[model samples]
Target chain A: MRDDVPLAATAAGGTRGDEECCTLATGPLDAADAQRLSEAFKALSDPTRLRLLAHVADQGCASVCACDLTELMGISQPTVSHHMKKLVEAGLVTREQRGRWAHYSVVPAAFAELRAFLDLR
Target chain B: MRDDVPLAATAAGGTRGDEECCTLATGPLDAADAQRLSEAFKALSDPTRLRLLAHVADQGCASVCACDLTELMGISQPTVSHHMKKLVEAGLVTREQRGRWAHYSVVPAAFAELRAFLDLR
Candidate 1:
């Protein structure tokens, strides 16, 4: 009922847990892959996360400073950090620490994997 | 942490409720659209939902019978119904009640909209 719960918290899998199910044209999505895939989608399940991702992608280069994310997202530093942590855990974004600030970037391979998995093309 | 909660349940928007954020190459996703888009992805965030969707898509026809879904999914009729309700609410699938059976089909436009929204293609 609490809508603010991030996707990281949402895609926590069933009591059946690690069991896999279903087949696509490619093949069945096993439990491990499905679990990981769901987590990635869950990361994108939030508006803030989507914006955060856009901000990173909007950077267009390899990465952007963590400090820059706070300004771009128009959110408090801690809030941005929270969402970025979830995104990083989901593997949607990669973080690199430089000097004192962490830099974040979109992982094209993650997006590409999702695209293929969804067969959105 | 209960992963069984559907994406419709997951993308319930923030307490800020119905506010929009972030821009893609196309434009910023409004709160309503972000909510809707997130719901679609949330639906996909589950392996069960993904499998259900695949079964429907595998039908290759415009629709599949609700009764048929119960068999294909290998879940109980009620469990299938529960997930189907969430999918319906998400606008990912369409249901038509015919006689005593409800025939379900994937909404191409919903997937198309998500594809464009995510820039997944």
Candidate 2:
């Protein structure tokens, strides 16, 4: 049995023929999009990371500094850095360096895309 | 340092007083809710499982049969069964057995809750 199905060439939930299906409910998710979504989900699979994300997101448009995260989370600089790195790599959040510290903000589009997928209606 | 945060009594993105905050944007995510959200995300971390979810979701309220999934995914019956189990455990999908076949349907509320967290705006 060919259990190892080949990844679909089309982007995840991309135009499948004439139908304009984007979310999971609209149609089958392509392999490429699945890979991308899975990575983002993986980044959010950890409790600590989720908390950190919540803290950063709580700040709204205001970016949270790495130094502040160290105190808020009561974790070491490296621990916060590690989690922040994962969040940034997953495209869930954006990172910017301002002076001596790195600031992070939620990428609204990313969450919206994920929310759209779950919105079955 | 108390890096290991104790789980909060409130639900994920639940009320923090009269403030009426119900999402990641409003306030910090408690450990209890973080663990729940992380587990749900863990279920979506697999590409194969995600594809399966999309397929099930595509069916909408109609529901998808396990036998059909085996053929649709081009994977073994056992493999499909395994993945389905995880989705079911994660509360991403609901399963019902009819006759000799197992049917699966997406859980809208579960996805809605997860989507709310990502809805930073």
Candidate 3:
């Protein structure tokens, strides 16, 4: 819901040479970072969205069309669009137009940031 | 919300030697796993809860009392208790009672499962 907090910026921020590790165990998270992560996690908090994302991620280097997702997930096109919009806005997924349909792919950096944040060591 | 999908069972399921890797990139998640993960993610979807979890995780080997979290997060006792309840129910955090106050700690395996799920490899 907090689209104001961009996952791309947080992922980029984590890579700066002097930056401290972004894991939750390292230290208390500031409000801004917490906002960003909570937004990303919220985008992932739905079962339908998680399955949709997994389908896309499972494709590896290949991208999947929105129409294919609707068919695959057995959901309406509008529902797919709604979930995809949330994922793209949260920066976990990227959308690109190919002809009339939109194609999506997982943004590796975003997932990496999330994974890094969960690191308890 | 959907607390029926226990995270401890999922974390334990991941450790079975014959089990497939749990990363989202590897395969499509089944309905049950999706339900479980969504519940965990939903619990983490709030900013206050994320900061609260981080504070507990930052303690490493130690646990923090609920009273201490109320003071550190600058929130009222009820708010802290509410967030803590969500975290504990999701299996992302553990609760223990010592005398009058509840103590909390991060569940490392729960976080490891989340981190693993994000793997885009």
Model 1 CA lDDT for position A14: 35
Off by over 4 Å in 1: A1-30, B1-24, B27-30
TM-score, chain A, per candidate? 0.73, 0.78, 0.78
Clashes of each: 1, 0, 0
Over 4 Å off, model 2: A1-25, B1-26
Model 1: clashing residue pairs?
B20-B31
Complex DockQ per candidate? 0.11, 0.28, 0.25
Judged by DockQ, which candidate is best?
2
Across B9-102, the per-residue lDDT of candidate 3 in tens digits comes to 2122222232332236547899999999999999989999999998887766466777778777899989999999999999988788767778
Candidate 3 whole-model C-alpha lDDT, 0 to 1: 0.77
User: How does each model score on TM-score?
Assistant: 0.73, 0.79, 0.80
Preferred candidate (lDDT higher): 2 or 3: 3
Give the per-residue lDDT digits (tens) of candidate 3, residues A2-120.
Answer: 23533222122222232332236447889999999999999999999999999887766556777778877899989999999999999998888867778777777788788877887
- Candidate 3's interface RMSD, please? 13.7
**Residue-level lDDT tens digits of model 2 in A1-121:** 2335332311223213323222355478889989998999999999999999988777655567777788988999999999999999999888888677787777767887787767665
Number of residue pairs clashing in candidate 1, backbone atoms closer than 3 angstroms, sequence gap of 3 or more or interchain: 1
